[model samples]
Target chain A: MKTSRFALAVCLLFPALAFAHIGQGDIGGGLVAGFKHPILGLDHVIAMVAVGLWGAQLGRPAIWVLPVTFPLVMAFGGILGGLGLPLPGVEIAIALSAVALGLMVAFAARPPLWLAGILVAFFAIFHGHAHGAELPDTANAISYAVGFVVATGLLHALGILIGVAQRWRGGAYALRGGGAVIALGGLFFLASHFSILPGLDA
Target chain B: MNHFNAGFVHPLTAFEHVLAFAAVGLLIGQHGLQKAQFLILIFPLAVALGAAGARALPGLPLVAATNLVSLILFGALTALAKPLPHAALLAFCCAFGLTHGYANGSATTAQTSMLAFAAGLFAATFLVVAYGAAAAQYLLQRKISWIDIAVRVAGSWIAAIGLMALAIGMRGGLGR
Candidate 1:
């Protein structure tokens, strides 16, 4: 009877064992996760969209240059993060991006193309490094990059749509109001990361 | 079946190839059908020649460096959104299409049926380009500048991926 019981247990356990690692090392799974990384993060969303908003406010060449500069610089940052290079205050910098870009949009600040490009690129490093540091060992590097880049671009697009509201007088005021809200959110994120607020840290 | 599958799967499997094909389409769409006439026609022909050349000369260097470079350059141009002259765009497309076709050709084997492989490759490329061009043309027709700008931003992402691929290649070559 005991032998039969043992045999039955083995049969039952074998099925579970076969699927123990299912979805654990899949490249496609990793790609999906990477795609969701930016979407899942509030900090990333605010800053990425703010970039597009600011670009639209600035208009013309700034519109293209800001977005163009970001991913290129961010890739460098990701490579650095992948190499295990330590970058201090990445979280703080990410939070700061939201604040700065929000204010830029709110004020309708029109910096030169070079300055706008530099500012966006500066903030992108922290965001990219954060995402890159979390890469799965078993993930296809190229696919993961493609996934996250697509996600980031989509976020920027969303911001551009919102920023287009600035083309109208009432819409411009609404965008400014939205920018203020985004800036406030960034400040809250900054405070929370620093553990300055008691209940807010959670 | 194997030849057809191999050809069909090759470009889809490579992010660089997929992005490059889409970028070409986006460019053509942005410039409009009239201005991109030469480019639209010459690209596939160059691709066919490149694939044939690769098969004919098996010992040719297939370093993939050119592919990375093309990805970086064209992606940047797409983001810039400036219209390139037809002659320039045509030359660019021919050069890139040839190089990429060569890479795609390397995937085939002696047992592969030439007709099947060519058909599969042609179908995939045609579809990718056609889809991108149609989508872009639709947005432009609707005057949806937001979506258009989004496409341009996507080009930046492609360039970034190219940079990453380049870095990876360098790291692999340097054994670190």
Candidate 2:
């Protein structure tokens, strides 16, 4: 059981770490590189899932709207970041986004759809802004945005689909269990944020 | 165009471009001929715009503006039911697309290579859409929530990264 649990935990984090583009090599590798980033990074993988799961937890119109809205808003925010706008507490806010989102899942706190949308959009602004700001001039902008945003939405849909089993035995419990996992991940992120761990600082 | 070893162009030249295209592919479930057709059309147009923008404006600080917008919008997306003002946003994509194109106008390429470069991008985009659609389908068949939690954690982390960008940009802007 412990072995399977370990495997499951690894699966949980597989996407995000796999998709880290911080080390994205070259400027013209184009699609080949785009194809590989999410495959390799765990962070990208998990972020995708959280979108789906949270979308499902909120349910209803949010089930569809929030997921769609996030990427669009995120892309805009990314453009802002790319264009060099001024906002405050980005790093802290990102960490907080992780923590707050995880807690929402852990506590199964279901805010209204509009509120949920607002919450995700706030974080997305930060998320999109950062990615956009970092876009290399040598790289193609729209393509880059497409890569990350698409990966993000798929992950959300996966979460919702997984949440579907919630109708079956242990499904809701499983979701909550997933939340616990998110919370733990948040703790690791926090430790890394404070520079207290030998973390990837992503 | 710069000559690379083995007569094959270096791949990184258009690396992130792949991600953007692939991302859209992955997002919409990859179903129907319409989606594929739409991607084929929008992608090229977007690329043309991006290439053109890259030619006209070359500034690293522009990311600051895009990043700030994401932060504001992310909050709304998670808790809201309203659709974004589609026209303005679509216009943003067009403008944003131009910036991308203009930025890379100087990279390795054929003076006549716009079509080739776009072809490369389209191929990459197709793969991502396929992958995303496939993965969504696969998950629908799985008994998993760990992945969901993992994704949420990542979203949070990304948000944090954005926050950091905001601070750094402000600091740089203030000359402190």
Candidate 3:
């Protein structure tokens, strides 16, 4: 998966669009709101990327297992977080996950596959905590989680494109220097986290 | 159908909501699914917190501040078209989202305002994002700053509308 140095560079400059919303109380609505949150908000955007980057870097069974496990663990976490179970630093954890995952991708560092999965699953807990904490009274907590998992799997597929995104249609980043620019890309989110970048007026 | 849907519909269905949700859609088109899923899962929780914040404080100008800030930040996001290099977006979303959620909650009656409205608005918001992504797909190769230009232009309109709504709210006292 080799990407052009310039194109991927531009994406890094702009962290990309992410949509996420959380509502508590309505069983159906919560599920819907919960489902929408990750897709809409920017926070979840980087975290999802790290999942794919790390998965790609690790390769193989991880490619299959990591994505599946992450959402499952995340759903569990969402229940607890929405229920308002005490979990310190859920926000911070979410922030840190982005950093950790991005670093993994930037360096193309490959830990053992199982270790990588554990890392993602652990991060998924924080993501879930944040999700669960905001559960709407109307949302069916379990169903809301299922929606997220489905959505998360789809996100992984996009990240996988790095392997094929560069050349054409899915083949873009499969070349040798494809991910050479990934490190710089990681800088955008990391810098954003620390407030080093200029403010976004949008 | 009822008062609940009416109020809930406004926040989720309003043009700005549509545009902001489009920001997410663009993310799916430009970024990837895990990223989109992450946004879907986390933001609402943040909004719930924001809603709770509004409930707790409900102070002067908070609603206006949140709306104005979101408009500006989202407009900037559209304009800049980059992953914010820092927590700018996060700060932006959290402060505004809480207030938005609280506003959503406040908009409805306890009985009618149940989850249905939330679902309606959420569904509508996502549809807009998805549409935005689809709409922008052909132009994905172009710099989003151009998209930002259109967004800001629309944002100016939203600000105008917000002010008018504010005036109307002032006269009527509270959102309808």
TM-score for the B chain of model 1: 0.89
lDDT per residue for candidate 3 within A1-202, as digits (tens), equals: 3568776555333321211222222235434664586776555666686676566556565665565456546755754565457898676567667667766765567788778878888988888677556655454433354355446655665676554343353442332233434434445555665667879311
Question: Which residues of candidate 1, in runs, are more than 4 Å off?
Answer: A1-29, A59-61, A83-86, A167-171, A198-202, B53-62, B85-88, B130-151, B168-176
Which candidate leads the pack in TM-score?
Answer: 1
Estimated TM-score for each candidate: 0.78, 0.48, 0.40
Task: Put down candidate 2 lDDT per residue, A40-141, tens digits, no spaces.
Answer: 444444545666777777666566666656766766576577667867766556556666776777677887777888888888787666665655444433
Please give the ranking of all candidate structures by DockQ, highest first, separated by commas.
Answer: 1, 2, 3
Candidate 3, which CAPRI tier?
incorrect
Worst 10 residues of 3 chain A by lDDT: A15-24
Docking class of 1: incorrect
Ranking of candidates on TM-score, top first = 1, 2, 3
What does the lDDT read for residue B165 in candidate 1?
A: 52
How far residue A7's Cα lies from its native spot in candidate 3, in Å, is 50
Q: What is the DockQ of each candidate?
A: 0.21, 0.07, 0.02
Q: lDDT ranking from best to worst?
A: 1, 3, 2
After superposition, candidate 2 runs with Cα above 4 Å error: A1-45, A197-202, B1-176
Sliding window of 10 residues with minimal summed lDDT for model 1 chain B: B167-176
Q: In order, how many clashes per candidate?
A: 0, 130, 84
